[model samples]
Target: MNKYSYKDLPSRRERLFIALRLPAHIQHSLRLSAELVQGKLDFRKWTDHRDYHITLQFLGDTLVSDIGQLRKTLRSAGAGFQPFELRVSGWGTFGLEEAPKVLWRGIEGELGQLNLLQKRIVEATSSLGYKAELRPYSPHITIAKKFLGQVPGNEDKGIFGVLPEQDLSDNSWLIQDFVLYVTQPGQTPMYEVVDAFSFS
Candidate 1:
């Protein structure tokens, strides 16, 4: 007789997602972009650069019991997407400039492949009981959220407006793998990669 049962396995509910992790250099570049306006903004929670990533699929409040199944599904879903080059192109927000909910950096290059991979992930998990967000998938690295108020108009224009010509997006990173992450809400550096599935 076994001393441990499946019921006795350690488990916890998690807010989770699968994402493409950025390299150190690209990560710093994004932080620099946000830093350009850090002093000007007030009452906003900026994301830590270390947590920057491009979310492919968000699995909200996942049950610990379902992880094994999800892992297998993710591996199957991720297999067809060969490695691709991804570049950060520009900035965008979830709402109007004057009243934004989330500020993010936009993605370009090989996005069609990115979308196809995400489509497979969504389709794979739908039958397993994962519900994809209804909104169309827009890939970006969220730089900040929970905006309490807006920056002064001139400064806002300086930052959020059509930004002045800059070399922010010239760097490109190869995305060879995607990973599953567990997010710790109300914690510093919320997303932690728990497992990675590589593309062939």
Candidate 2:
């Protein structure tokens, strides 16, 4: 018989953060819109299209040993909520006027439902010993980061001539399922369908 150390095990066995999927059409539109502002106003480096998602809760890093219980808790917590429609619109950045670290768009409509979903997710995973977020939840899909000065790498002043404003269209989608995702630095993140408890 041979004994193996924890470091020798495969990395895929790690636990993941979980979130809800954004509909394809809305994602496409957001990508196009982002390109229009690519060189202007010190936008944060953009996230890849496939990485786009509306996070319900950030589970942070967890040991592989804990994933099984997390899944079970999510299933139980998610059982009561039914599918709901969410609309994506508007854009903003975080930080002071001189420095913005994140650029993202806001979610609209079905606000109550979204909040309920987040609360349940938090409740489900709270017992895992992770630190819970104390601030009020504000749902937004982050598009960019790493922004420091006035649009670094661009010398053309014209690039900052016009900044894009938020779009207020009613782009909606039905949320049918959520997912658990494992993110690793310098590697593509992996996702798994923990359990899809359907909404009525």
Candidate 3:
């Protein structure tokens, strides 16, 4: 008999769904742009540039046993899409201007294709028993989080400064594939390519 039983073994890892890699030039531009926003507002904890990505879907956590079928389904879903161009620009917040919680950069152009792809992925994954996100998808790169009780436009003294209205030229990126990522609670997440299916 083995010394270790199932109860004594390490738990399975968490799983996530992620988008394909951004072009090098686009990644550079986004990093530089984020630097420009530093110290300008009460930005939430700045995300590391290495961690920057556009999420196609969030699988939350899943058992390792479920990963193989999830990958096959996602590949089939992604195979229907062709590569498209995406533009990133501007600054914005989620929720009311008086009580914003998420600070994000806007994504424009190729919006329709992105939506279609997202819908397909959701449909494909949902068939595999994953909980589907109920919120209407708004694609944006989250940059920061807002403090509690802080309202935008309140001009409260000595708390944090307002983010200046920025004039951003549209930065474009090409999408070629989608990736599957795994997120671990209480640890830096790990990302591995489950499958890379290209669009036209």
Best by lDDT: 1
Residue 85 in model 2: lDDT:
87
- Model 3: per-residue lDDT, tens digit, 1-200? 02234244436655566575556666566667667655444445665555566787888767665666777787788875777888876777777666577777788888898898888888888898876678888888776676454344535732224554444454787787777765534543234455566664
Q: Which one is best on TM-score?
A: 1
How many residue pairs clash (N, CA or C atoms closer than 3 angstroms) in each of the candidate models, in the order given? 0, 0, 2
lDDT of 3 at 113: 89
lDDT (0 to 1) per candidate: 0.78, 0.69, 0.66
Root-mean-square deviation per candidate: 3.9, 5.0, 5.4
Estimate the overall C-alpha local distance difference test score of candidate 3. 0.66
- Compute the lDDT of residue 93 as modeled in candidate 2: 66
The sequence of per-residue lDDT tens digits that candidate 2 reaches over residues 107-137 is: 8888998898888788778787755688898
Q: Can you list the residue pairs that collide in candidate 2?
A: none
Better TM-score candidate (2, 3): 2
* Model 1, residue 134: C-alpha shift (Å): 1.5
Off by over 4 Å in 1: 1-11, 150-159, 162-164
